[model samples]
Target: MNSHQPDLRAAVRRLGRRHFLTLTAAAAALAFATDLPAARAASVPELDARKIAENPFTLGVASGDPLPESVLLWTRLAPRPLEPDSGLPDKRVVVTWELAHDETFLRIVRGGTATAHPEFDHTLHVEVTGLDPGRPYYYRFRTGTWESPTGRTRTAPAPGTATSRLKLAAVACQAYHHGYFTPYKHLAGEDLDVVFHLGDYLYEYAVDSAGGSRAYTDRVLPAHFNREAMTLADYRLRYALYKSDPDLIAAHAAHPFAVTWDDHETENNYAGDTPENSVPPEEFLLRRAGAYRAYWENQPLRAPQQPKGPDMRLYRRLQFGQLAQFDILDTRQYRSEQAHGDGWQKARPEAEAPSRTITGETQERWLLDGWKDSSATWNVVPQQVTFAQRRDKPTADFKLSMDAWDGYPASRQRILDGAEAAGIKNLMVLDGDAHVGYGFDLKKDFQDPASRTIGTEISTTSVASGRDGADKPANWDDLTQANPHLKYYNGRRGYTVITLGTDRARVDFKTVSGVTKPGGTLTTAASFVTEAGRPGLTPA
Candidate 1:
């Protein structure tokens, strides 16, 4: 491959052999159409299965950010997915989407034609509205007689109504090459209203261990991903590769996902525009813009979340009638540079500085305002990273992970204080990123173990990143002892199933026995519930 061009084979290899198939010459023609001049691109022929090599719906379908009356639907045309241009011609193609009350489309509620723009990597995001609240809908997309798999999505209950309960799953950190996304298979089987993915959706590490600490897989890494994603095309292709997972696709088709990124989406441990490696400010901003754009294009997010250069407005609020208010946060884009340059370290004055914010000024203010305005039975903060303070060692010394909220002491305190001031009775915090799962009681003050408990936190484990992690970490007992607020901890590959009710919120720490191969058995490793108006977990 030439130094200037991306390695298409490497992009396909990221999906591994199980999910991706080599495309035929006809399909390859579509992908390489980018090599043609702009005038020739306009004259590209229509796609036909007999003329093409593979199915364009290789990436499947997804829905997200569901409102009471509207939902965002997504699909990408990837006949030759591993190809540099997803086997799509260098022009916009028309895609027809249909939403109905039945899976058969017999009762079409909404139907429209949308363009799959080559500018956005041939991905389609159709925002369908005017649907009744709290109703389940089936949607599908098609072009040239080829149809996408039907996806199921539910609109949120009408706001201000007295909703009784909500079922949600919080999942994150699925490194495609690390292992199978078996957890998503289980997540798909669950009855969840919505899914929250707290970042590391796709790791930017190269296929080789030399690029980062990620486990090297047998599959070859693309030259573009051999280091870190730097260009818009690189990030877009990376997202396409990860979206090829059948399990991941099924999960997305099953439920709407509210996503937020932690590190590894662009580069490992990237803090805002400051990359882990010493890339120049302008270069890093360009890379961030690419990453953000690719993320929005691939996911079923709305147009409002589109990236403006390096900046994207991701932190927003979603209401579930009177049952819950989800304050989906973007912790990565706004956070100040990781104090002490990232990783676990002894607490420093700078780490706790009031100005060292993780959510930035605008987003933090938005979150605080959401808390104040919320009138739902449960106020849930769906975010990345642990919310409660965690001491790494068992000793009396103060050592916390600089990568988490523990590093932004003042910011965390403000959130906790805001929750209290808002008279939040059932403040539930949902987060992911520590491949290991954790259950914690949100503390009003972490310095005092006996301080008033402000809420409950359910930190989900990785979808597969840890591979087949042990049932428990080596120092599990010590860590739990060191942090009294932490109720449970498990080192496993899975997600958390949460049931929020008017009287209580129950959480089942669902763990997969393994991820090295497909078909891992999912079992509830632990169950706990926090009663309404009272904080802290009790045996469910």
Candidate 2:
């Protein structure tokens, strides 16, 4: 490390915190911004197909961000996925894609050509339009003689169509070193209209050369992946490693996913404009820029979701006719730092500060306004972290997860109060993280068991982060006893299935027996039904 670096950071910190961060963030990405067009300008570097040694579609293909009439298709040309440059030359390659009505490509409907520039890591995104609403479409990409794996995607129901039903699966937290992606394989086979990946798509931590917990004896991974991701190339390579999993690829191919990121996508428990460790904000912003850009290139996001410097607008709404309206949130990007210095802590005055916000002012306003005008029968919210309050033990001096909504009392209160004011009768909240499944009746006052059940929150277990977990965790009894609002709890590796019909909503807590080994058994641990105009969980 440079001896003078500390002095430089100290000088930078003298300026106003908010304004200085904005300036430094822009400064950090200026060079990256200026370099993109330079590489894009030298775009004509085509070579004969015979000269290429192997197929470049090793990463497979995916489609996401579905609309009533359109959906985005994504694929990267990665003959060698873990390479720094994805093993592709610094040239633009013309990739053609076809959307067909059948899996065999027997009936081609939409076709187009897009240039996959190395400036954007040779990823291709084709937004297909002019399609019938509430239908399935098969798509694939081709360049020269090589073709990608066929992917199936479905569009949302038409607006005001009075849809009778909607099916969705929520998943997240797939750390490669923890276990195998067995849950995704099971999820791929389930009949769902759409999938929502609630973040932590990939961890920033290092993986062993033997492929971490999987302990791969068949092959050894590269040494570059044995360290934390810190640079743009590092983050990109990390994504390639996670995406190369066959089960994850299969899940993407099976259904279009709407995704949002959590802390692990950049760093663990990092708050808005604040690094988890004691790292300088300027340095963290530079790292965040790389993480954000790599996220955009890899995911099947549209142009509107693209990143600028260290910022990206990932929060948006997706409606499924009149059955459900999903307000996808980005809580990690705008939350205040973890109060009381991380981990579980008792309530503190700083945590209750009205000025300390989880969703920044603008996003809070957006969410409130969206709720006020919502028309769907079930107003669903897919966000990071737990919503209901969770205490450590059955006592008045109980501690709570400082990283979750429990630390942001004021923010949670505003949201809960807003729901009641808007006359939101059937409110549903889907949360990720915790590495365990929890069904909570969101209440206005946790101290009172009879408090109004303002909403319902179904928190899904991790995909593979916690390895093979048991049904009853060590603190299961304590957690269930202390928090009366918490109706269910299970420590397992799996996702959750949420189905909305015309009159009611049902949530199934799906659990996998194991993820350390292949072919884990998937079973519904529990199921709950909440009737329309009644915000509570009833055993189904």
Candidate 3:
């Protein structure tokens, strides 16, 4: 063979075995589609198969942020609805959406159609704008003869529209195998303007990690997912399974969700390139790229969140008129490793080591700048994990999880100091990931009892993670007693409903009996209020 021809053959071989397999699969698919159902079999009428198969919007329709003139409409067109788990073939469906002033959609304001391609799981995100702000609207989608359920949504108040009040429900940590999402069902019923999911919307762990434990008994999941999610298909299945939950669906249909992801969205204790399982560098990048792509495909986020390789830009700002400005941060992607031995091991006292960061340099600056420049009365830091420093102090034997902000003490203090220095009063940090609810004064230092409180931090418990329950250890009581800065602590599974106004913001901790039980009741377990400029939490 000629040298050039030999090189061409080598090049083809270098395309990798997986690529070759994919080509074979594609060819097989084409052959199968052509051979079967050129027309339907006599057993099933060709017309019926043709007719039924035409309807594409099988997963249902959802709309977020219903402005007076525009709304964000989402739908996944499933050509094979019954075989929901199956990937879409080479097919395209046209999704027609309409927004109306009323639920009946009698007065349609905006109407358009977009093509949903199989590559995107036939999902379409139509962010329609040009409507009035701070108004409720109803929307739905149509594909062929099928129609999705109409969803209700409301837009943000026009920028700087000095609103008197706004209600937002904050929640996070929904482990699929842990329990039912009845808490979401309750939240869907609540009268709220917006919902904020701090992080851990889905766990990356396999089913067996949960084991056949207390709450995992009745849990149902996709047949696969025995390993950590690494492929786009794996992520899609994970999301599909989560979205199938009635409560989760209800909540999405009920209110717009402002979301961020914690470690579990990609991998446990994941910090940029370092994953908990120690994925090899190149392999980890590939996995991250896949995970990020799938996340963008499923979430109702704006286009900016579309991932580029392994990175998805999740940190952004959401405004609720002049009442509040929510600064959502991605804490997992830019952080140092957790301290070993329960995270109590202090970093080496050297400048470089103690200076290890959680938010990285750029994100830290962004957060601080956003806080400083905000004009809203309530500056809400919608972040993942507890902001207060965990004391593993005199007893070096005791250690806290290094995965959290506590592990980066210097960085945490810098954030607190930045807010204080910027004169950004009324700072409220809403966090999740501890699987336990906590109320703390965001102080310069938690180790020092006399540290000045700069703001308030409310760490909401998980929605369905098994770590949350009514049971509390006696040691928890001892910890609270020792730490006066910690006002309250609970291991209940629930969320926080926050109501913000000009003078004060109230956070109501809504607790659920248990996540394993479907349709569990929710009640306000505790409530805290922060007066404007007070910068500290007061009992509501």
Candidate 4:
């Protein structure tokens, strides 16, 4: 076992003290109700395991990627409720899945059988193909005598088809300990074509550990995560616990998901070889290897994402027929550490810097060359973190966070320069991370007032996790004012919805009252639009 495990345990113990105090306050509030007949009664409500078995798939079934011919289906078999801690069972069960053109069983199209092994924590990913495009389908899974609830899914129209429009939702940053995922539950109710998960899907922290920035609130998670996850079983159990959330599963079942991971999937502020928590170089690699393996096994990704040790090349292009092409980029795992300097200084070694890289040499060339050659009307770069260069003035003493693309100035400039050189039109950047929403005009130089805008970016805030504690609103507001490029900023939790049409694209920023609460109302706080050939964002 790693020596650092002791340090992590100590941190959790310290955090427990604070949690106990909060619980005491809650107990005091409930103490008044003790006089009621129900409270005075000696018997308490009891839960029976046999009753829960009647609904084996309580977490629900989900499908993603409704393509003209295929869609990915997912489900987990939780056979033993009493053994929730391990989320593993020794017995292997045969899982049967079927897809139909209609909600009823009359038009069955595809069917298959697979085994849910204990090694994968009883979770299964079934990619069903050979279905008609642009048509809705319903699917379900069966294990022994238990049947999962049916889920609906649809595929994208074939390339260059006569489809009029497409609706997609963008979201990210869901830390289970931070808040409830009520926003996802709301998004699942909408009629969407696909969901774009930009990143920060799971946080790698022990449950009792005080969220680095805030105290625990009303959100629920496992009672204890005593150590940093390094083994495959540890990672598997973490994903299982997260996937069990009904809201997340509902959203996944409602529409297809296009996903990418940000720092928290491994560690906060992780650069190429170094993580923010500063695990030794050798140990970091091993942890990364296990983390990547778990990520691939849990996600509904294509075969290309199969993990090989610590590396899983996730940057790839997904075409949505003739309407658009998504070039998902990986900004982590291949960048230099933060530059050392005084104040908000610009990175030195501008043109000849051989050490700085964001997309790496190969991926950068691939992205630029792909942009130059693509024929789609919209060039969408669905990536993690912000791309717009954010800088604090010389006297402000603010520098770029080493974890984001801003740390690699040379490479960022090159990508922008490539777009200019390629004359790529209608370039839209979908960004996450930074826990705040922003719509910026991506300019070659932010310092220069006369700098021309190159493209447009729509940054989504955190789905659940963000700035916690007393300074929340103040910090968010100050960041927004400092960065004039930001169009909207909210300390509250929520997600974004985008609709792409032939001539225009509309983006709606939806915020929930609070994720710390079980359920919250959602409202569109702001909206923006981008015309097909204009390439810049405008108020909707």
lDDT scores in order:
0.81, 0.86, 0.71, 0.69
Off by over 4 Å in 1: 1-53, 208-227
| Candidate 2 TM-score, C-alpha based | 0.95
Highest TM-score, which number?
2
Q: How accurate is candidate 1 locally (lDDT)?
A: 0.81
- In model 3, the worst 10-residue window by lDDT is 1-10
Worst 10 residues of 2 by lDDT: 1-10
Error of 4 at 482 (Å): 4.1
Error of 2 at 298 (Å): 0.8
lDDT rank, highest first?
Answer: 2, 1, 3, 4
Per-prediction count of colliding residue pairs? Answer: 2, 0, 5, 6
Residues 1-540, candidate 1: write the lDDT tens digits: 111232334433454433333223212322343242243546554444344456789999999998999999999888877668777666557788999999888999899898775666778889998999998999998887688999999999998878888998999999876788889998898888999889899987555422222233344445555555666677777787688778999999999988888878788877776788886554555566567768887888898987654577888889999999999998887789989878889987989788899889988888888888888889998999898989987786758889899989888988888888888889888898889999998887777989898899999999878778998689788788889998999998999999989898999999998888767899999999999999899988
In candidate 3, which residue pairs clash? 66-154, 66-155, 68-132, 69-131, 69-132
**Which regions of candidate 2 deviate over 4 angstroms?**
1-20, 23-28, 31-34, 37-39, 42-44, 47-50
lDDT of 3 by residue, 213-323 (tens): 324445444456556666656776677667766788788888877778887878777776776665455455456656776677777777777665566678888877788
Clashes of 2: 0
User: For each candidate, C-alpha RMSD in Å?
Assistant: 8.0, 3.6, 7.7, 12.1
Tens digits of per-residue lDDT, candidate 2, 34-104, equal 36635446655765544547789888889998899999999988888877767777667788899999999
Q: How accurate is candidate 4 locally (lDDT)?
A: 0.69
